[model samples]
Target: MNQDERMFSIDVQSVNLAEYSSKGIVLDIGGGGEGIIGQLLGDKVVAIDPRSDELEEAAEGPLKIVMDARELKFLNKTFDEATSFFTLMYIEKQYHQKVFEEVYRVLKDDGEFTVWDVTIPPYPGGTKDIFLVPLEIELRGKKITTTYGVLWTKSGQDMNYYIQLGERVGFEVVKKEKNKQIYCIGFKKKTNAN
Candidate 1:
């Protein structure tokens, strides 16, 4: 389980959350399962998830809220930093735009939104992009092969789509990292002061 956790957290580990400061608030989207980022950020993080059972399993410390990402219940410009780790794949494509809008709406001026997720490889015909990726792991000396459902957009849409969306919603792409399995993007909310 520990190895599996590390395997899934590769992208999360790439972000330097310490740069945001322990005092700053970070909203972790779909972070209730392991709350690894929350655990890393301590009291500075607020993790939200629609699954109450997962929320209950989160380690004690970070504030946990049961909510949907499509419609966040936060005031405008409320969060200094927001993060989404491998979350978009599970959501239907239609809701993605709304969720992006909500993330932009709740971030403070100059606030940053960091996202780490996988982009699907192109398939023939391009009608569908979702794929089942097989992952092998060893737990308690037994080898286990598990599969994860992944959604990949045709072409570079997986990464470009969010960049375009951020531009549309008043955010500037500050950093971009294209890793082996996942990519990371950081967008800073643009304000008149800038």
Candidate 2:
């Protein structure tokens, strides 16, 4: 297969990420590139990404930080909310659990963690080395369209994968929505009383 044939784009409907107001600081993991969450939440978001260049590419709104998701630098119960908007697909499968643990640790009691990601199927044999999801994000009466591509490998992820990981890290699934191959999940950190 040639280079062109190595890339596969899925046919998915446009996913709308509506703008919402937040009461406190939101920790946006992998909040770089377009920085969708940062753009939506403005200064209330503390966006972090592992790569400096990625953070540099993000729009000016959130407080950008260069940090790893697996080991967050914030104190326990620091953030009121956290978000991962189409970011987890970039992380390797082995680090996902650690990322969840770190997110759970840094969030305050009853804090919410929302995630938006696509369902990626396992890599089929042959030269399909890239899987791409074209997203048309609708926010605050504007539209931003982009394509996120990741290397196609053996791992396959969906809503259930995240739900189980969140549960293992003491998060309760409060909401789940699916739009075509994309999904949104809202998870609340479980406090002792609940």
Candidate 3:
């Protein structure tokens, strides 16, 4: 199986989407629409993407296909584990918090939420200074912006903003860390915050 045949998606392989992912209704936000996990997990997933047909292929399988974000359908507290790998970088701040809020809403109490994404170095939290460095590169003899002074050059978000946003949504910061360009962000369902 080259790649398309074996059916391994970056969203799954990159984040260990199949193994660590338990047997339950795992939600894959923007799962490349191919949805390898739907098959790998077997009756344990609901793949949501803008193109509904992407998941339609897996209809015979145990996957539930949807054509929207977690907010569009599915009642609150509807999932066991939720994952957004490389998808959050594309998320806008306005809707970013809502996604986190929705994740909190959809996950059962004490459930775990994991996010895999690219971000700058110097973890814990980042200030503006860490983001203001101008990275330059040449393309076709023309200068192109490799990495901007902000997160937009990235998945369109600062590494710090996401961590803070998770806190705001009442999720206890179970763990947060960064390795090279990969950042592992973990948030547990809200409980006693007193």
- Best candidate, lDDT: 2
Q: What is the TM-score of each candidate against the true structure?
A: 0.73, 0.95, 0.63
Name the regions of candidate 2 deviating beyond 4 angstroms.
Answer: none
Error of 1 at 129 (Å): 9.3
Tens digits of per-residue lDDT for model 3, 1-194: 24223221122112233335464688877654334444455567666766666566543454565645637476767777877655665555567877887778878777768776665443333233223322232223233332222332323454577789888888877777665445668788865332
Q: What is the lDDT of residue 49 in candidate 1?
A: 90
Cα error, residue 53 of model 3, in Å, equals 4.7
Which has the greatest TM-score? Answer: 2
Candidate 1, 136-172: lDDT as tens digits: 4323333434355554444434687778877877788
Displacement of residue 6 (Cα, Å) in model 2 is: 1.2
> Which has the higher TM-score value, candidate number 1 or candidate number 2?
2
Pairs of residues at least 3 apart in sequence or in different chains that clash in candidate 3: 89-155
- Candidate 2 accuracy as TM-score: 0.95
Cα lDDT computed for each candidate against the true fold: 0.70, 0.91, 0.58
Residue runs of model 3 more than 4 Å from their true location after superposition: 1-19, 34-40, 53-62, 120-156, 192-194
Candidate 1 stretches with Cα past 4 Å from truth are 1-23, 122-157
TM-score of 1: 0.73
Model 2: ten consecutive residues of lowest lDDT? 12-21
Residue 57 CA displacement from its true place in model 1, Å: 2.3
Order of quality (lDDT): 2, 1, 3
